[model samples]
Target: MVFEEGRIKQWLINYINPGMAFNDIKSVVTHYTALHPTKETYIFNDGTPMELVNLQGTIPVTYKSVVYNIPIIIWLMDTHPQHAPLCYVKPTPTMNIKVSKYVDQNGKIYLPYLHEWAQDKSELLGLVQVMIVTFSEQPPVFAKVKPKEALYHPSINNSFPNSVFMQQPPYPTHSPYPQPSYQGMMPQAAQSGYPPGGYPLYPTPYPAYPPQPSSMINTGTGTIKEEHIKESLLTAIEEKLMRRMKEEFQQNQAELDTLKRTQDELKQGSLKLQVVLERLEKEKSDLDKNITVLKDKEQELDKAIERLSNQESMDVDDAVITTAPLYKQLLNAFAEEAALEDAIYYMGEALRSGVIDLEVFLRQVRTLSRKQFMLRALMQKCRQKAGLTVV
Candidate 1:
């Protein structure tokens, strides 16, 4: 697919915030796309689907002074900078994956750079560089061996599509020791399984081993020594033991990683509990202080109640005693006015029941009203003299 740089930028600008994160993404995308174009898609993992930008291409790696191209795919998640990108070794059909400590059986690449990815420090470009360097030390894939005829016959090897060769690397690139080629059968060098111009140029470092004589194959049992058989058995046992040890080591490493993550979670939980405990302690202290204050206030109220209960009630005359003569006269006048009002009210009730003569009742009411009015006037005068408010 043609790489649409504009479309990719537009998508990023629309989705990512315009900040350090955006700039970091733009810089990496721009730099990487110079060598290879990008592809966009929505990808789903164990989690929810996300729109991702992926670069599927080869990066150059120099191994033993010979430059080789390693085919790989880098997936940039939507939450870039915050999280590291996913890297995978993309091998062709003829290429079988070579698993190492850095590259898993699934062709998923793992690196210290990826594991320790920091938003402030890490970049996508650096990650690609790391992958290149790591793969150069140990290539992640090797070309699958063809049939003996294809390997030995030049004409048969050339019959395969050149385009297929262009995509895949040559056979047995994972072997630390040099591969033994048959120069006697095929003279001219061509794509073992890879391209002519070296999409990944894997040159054989050692010359082909001489073919074994037919006479040796017929006398194999006679030539085979007891020591050689024992040695072969020991070598096989050692290899099996080594393989089992490696598997156990990988499993233990995974468990250790899980334990580390669990430890971190426990640390966070402990901090939260500490904070809660501190807040609870503060609340408890405040409650204790409040209880002390309430107890003190309760003691004061009880003392006031006890004092009032123990004291004798004052006599009416002593309670109503005034310091000034005008206050005393006002008090006496008020009492007389209230008594006369009651007497007048009772006389009116008696007249209504025909118990008193109308003439006597009217005379008594008139006298009582005159006396009440005089007493009220005297009370007002006395209050005014005493500097009190009169109603």
Candidate 2:
């Protein structure tokens, strides 16, 4: 939908003050003007007769011998003065704002002045004074120096209201008391410095409201009164900070304990794995030794069988020339006995040389002697029947 800029500009002229315009038809948010005809943004509403417009400005501030330019924004909702204007501080990109009692990390400034705002009694000048005072207590942290290009604005050089400049933070420590979070949905405000209260294109019919009085207005109030507010706000902030620190300490302690326990479990698991690995290595070595001994015994058995087969073939060839069948049989038996004797002699030699076990060879010797004696008796009987000389 098209907006009636001429009518809206005329309406802003009739309502706000003249000195707030700061010399041109426009004002800057971050060294840039919001006065362009296209910059006027509206929020569509189904119920309201008029739409709310977005207005932003850079409010110059000086604190602790340092000049800082902070941005303040406003949304002029239709249901205005009865509801407080949504006030926020948008620091430069190089600034790091703390989330404290008064200003949130999002740059939201919560002051009691909003609830006390009266349509006729309150002006944008008074609220700006509160913002300046609130921020003075706890200035934002600067990450780096702001760019020079952003600092070059005509509005930035313009002198701020003396009333805003005069207000101080609630403490001697350069900080304000921790105010509670903005309770709920915030309504918007019309700033005298911006279009609604003052715009250069349209002349102002109403003279400036001469600095309206606010509940937080710093009128000096004497030394005792200033000390009391500072002390109370300071005490409350200290208590809140202490509580937060304690909670963080407890959380860190819990995490450290959990990490220590995990480290201990890992150490135990590593020790158990080492023990199991050592045992497996030892068992493997023993099996290797046993396998070597068995292989040596197999080699000895193969040699013994080869020797026995060679002796049998030699005896059979000698017996083939004999004519008596009985004598041939006797001779074959005697050769078998001789082969057994040779086997016993080799086994004894192996045992003495430590190639074979002594007790194991002794057991085999008794078993072989019985077989040798039986073959000797059979050879003698065959020799007697054939009447062959026993050689």
Candidate 3:
């Protein structure tokens, strides 16, 4: 739970950047937490052995000179000094998209910055700023939004010709804006000579002129109408682009399916060929075994015929044959019983033959004592055969 002073100082440096603009987040700033888990049961939570920093903020992303505030959460993992943090875009529940390369239907976003994370020099604030700017290139295709109402500041889209007329004051207003009355009253005042509150010193009055039409202004600059046309044009272009993208996606999907089907067929053919190859190998082995059996049987038959032809001499060879069979049987029985020491002998043979690696033998020998394994003479013979050092 304790954080080293050096690590904590490095983390605190992420609060802001002197060179970059950091959009202030409304979420409450929280203290850092570190986890060191000794049990697998808490690996994802308390048992984590790294520092995890969680950041919640409205990431300011700009598109077409307009700014949008996208809410997101970032998780800096324990390997953060060496690993990139996890980022998630959190939109309102009702908003969802059907398709996007990075942002999911739930508005969770993925960016390329984390993919190329630099452990030695990477900082959290710098990373978030990069992500915010990257989103401008391809804003999320919203699943739902009002046609005119967007999450962007509306001032950029203002179509008024005279900006000064509609400029907002630095304070809030409680009522609707009053209509412009000066245009209508200007003509009336000129006709009455001088101003509405006439000064008494001026007895002379200008001759009354013909009254102009009382029709209100037209905002003759056509700024609002021009804006409507631009909006319509943009909508048309967007629709066309969407259709083209859909068409391309379907084509790619179809091609992928065809390739997948071909791959599956090739795999099936390969499996069949493998089965045929295995069957042929088994048959070849069986044929070789049968040939060996037939050769043995043929030798036995030849011997029997030979014995039949030499029946008269068979009695003369009986004394020699019986004595040889008794000695051979005694040797075979002894060999079988003495084979109990074969494992250690094989080890010695393998060591001498270089079949057992030196390092492996040395490691195993460290666990083995001479007295526990063999008689002193046998041990000496094995050691001599294996070229092992005296212990």
Give the TM-scores of the predictions, in the order they appear.
0.41, 0.30, 0.30
Candidate 3: tens digits of C-alpha lDDT, residues 1-391: 3324354445435433312111111112211121111100102323333233445435556766766555455654444445565555544333332224455433444455564467565666566667667666655432243334322324323343332222211211111112121121111233335344321112222222111211122345424454554554576466556655655676688789999999999999999999999999999999999999999999999999998898765564354442354344444433443563465566667888999987876665543434334444454554455565634
Which one wins on TM-score? Answer: 1
lDDT over C-alpha atoms for residue 274 of model 1: 100
lDDT to native, each model: 0.61, 0.53, 0.45
Give the candidate number with the greatest lDDT.
1
Poorest 10 consecutive residues by lDDT, candidate 3? 34-43
For every candidate, C-alpha RMSD to the true structure in Å: 15.1, 25.4, 24.2
Candidate 2 lDDT, tens digit per residue, 249-284? 756876899999999999999999999999999999
TM-score of 3: 0.30
RMSD of 1: 15.1
TM-score-based ranking, best first? 1, 3, 2
Residue-level lDDT of model 1, residues 9-49, one tens digit each, is 76566344425444554565566643443434433433334
Question: Which 10-residue window of candidate 1 scores lowest in summed lDDT?
Answer: 209-218
